[model samples]
Target: MALRLLLDSADPSAWAEWLPTGLFRGVTTNPTLLRRAAQPCNLEHLAELTARALELGAEELHLQAWGADLLGCGRALAQLAPGRIWVKLPITRAGAAAARALIAEGCPVTFTACYEPAQVLLAVALGADYIAPYLGRISDLGRDGHANLTRMQRIVESVRRVDPDGPGDRPDASPPLRLLVASLRSPNDLALLAAEGLDTFTISPDIATALFAVEPTLAAAAQFERDAEDT
Candidate 1:
């Protein structure tokens, strides 16, 4: 399939306006973005936001666990209606446990905050459909985030099973783990990942908007309109 462009925003208006464009694969949101969008309902506000996405015919609706502890995560998970929610989890001991429990129940999970091959491998072992490595966050620490993701991609590809000692299931041919690179900083960051052949990304609303408004593309469209008018 083509590269999946997803909006990583939680605003209800953003979803209502953007989903109709048919450019976004779906929406992905966290506690921070949702709070910025509106008063955080201890995540209770997400139900209406999700309903809006579904009403607009979204393909996927990804949400993050509001709390750090397993209980808190579970509480956050309970508020969401379960059609297409992929709960994002940390790689902590409690988080991994929650992810495995959810995975076993046939629920989709995206293991977030990953920064290394080990974490990526762990998510793959848990059968997480998506593993998100925070890109700009890693760069903030003066580390090479792209290099780290390269290593993660290698590790994900080498794994022969979804869960080696746990789920004990054979990995599918479609690549057991899908990388959803997060925390994008700019349009160049999006171009960088696309040039490197990465397929999925969770981009901020501003960046996603900027992506469709590049100078060259806009210029070409204007020229096409002018030529058609002359014709």
Candidate 2:
């Protein structure tokens, strides 16, 4: 299956054309993106944006929580944009607790700002639906981002093997916990991770375009077309 691509666009206008590409499985928005778009940090606004994204064919919508109060934020998030929404919480103690509660209530939660394998493990333990690790940020800190992701992949596999009946033993175990690689700096990062069998990636529109521009991908498409024509 094609690796699921999520568009990380701040400005809705910036994604107007990209949305029609039909390459994205979801959209992710955060405070920084909202600030760039000059949007308010309110549930109403978030719900509206999420609805709009859904209308544009986003299967999942990610909205980040701002304040330090996880319970309050989770409660509010649980009520906003009910369908196909993943409330993004930071990797904190309060956030984990809130995520656990929300997951138990059947609300999807995306644990963000994960920097270590331990963080991902904690999110999984809390029954999070997704985990967003900042790959570019880790690289900026002079760490090997791919290595970290590989480590996370291994840890996830190990856990699944030990406890096949664990919280993440859903039907789609291939994309376990929806490993959403965020903080992408370039298109190559997306391709590299996708090739590495990472589950999902959230990338800026510019990076998305660059990734779609890869020569090998285009060649493969052309070959498929040629074969279809011949047949």
Candidate 3:
């Protein structure tokens, strides 16, 4: 599968602006991003935020269900649109139970806050649809983020071998469990991770912008266009 880029933002306006570019597949947001984006973090607004995501052409929506509302958020998301909203749950014991409950109720999950490859194994065991490891944060903790990141493919394959009923099983029937990485330092990190064969990324808007913006490359394109016009 091709690499899928998702914008990490809480503001619906950002989704409206960026999803139209055809590069972003969706938006991944939690209450923290909402606070940063200056939007109200309330339960009443959940449906509206989700609807806004879909109206703006986002094919997928990753919403965080934290602080005693994992099941509540799953129920709320189910009311919005089917199969598009993947609730973000931390990989705690509660989170694992909540994920299983939510999946039983038809809500998929993205297990977040992973820092190690072993954590990835546990998430797969819980039947998470996606696992998001914080690359920059892992590096901040002085861990070998690249080693963990590069090991994801091998880890995932190993998990699938042991559990055929797990996510990523029977590729013809279902899309594999995706490793949706986040908190990358820059566009350069995105490039390196992509080179490592990581297929999905949830990046900040600045990194997303930088990914397409190269002054030297744009200048060359401009010169080529000018010469063609003159010719």
Among the numbered candidates, top lDDT falls to 3
State each model's CA lDDT, in order: 0.77, 0.80, 0.82
TM-score per model over all chains: 0.86, 0.86, 0.91
For candidate 3, give the lDDT of residue 1: 65
Once superposed on the true structure, which residue ranges of model 3 sit more than 4 Å away at CA? 162-166, 171-174
For model 3, name the residue pairs that clash. none
Order of the predicted models by TM-score, top scorer first = 3, 1, 2
Clash pairs of candidate 1?
none
Worst 10 residues of 2 by lDDT: 167-176
Best by TM-score: 3
lDDT of 1 by residue, 143-204 (tens): 99877777777676567434353432434322367889899899888787667767789888
Cα displacement (angstroms), candidate 1, residue 3, comes to 2.7
Those runs of model 2 whose alpha carbons end farther than 4 Å from true positions after fitting are 168-175, 213-231
Query: Residue 5 of candidate 1: its Cα lDDT?
Result: 72
Cα miss at 59, model 1 (Å)? 1.7
- Candidate 2 lDDT tens digits, 56-132: 77888788876877767766866766757788898888788777787777778899998998787887777777898
Which consecutive 10 residues in model 3 have the weakest lDDT in total? 167-176
2 versus 3: better lDDT goes to: 3
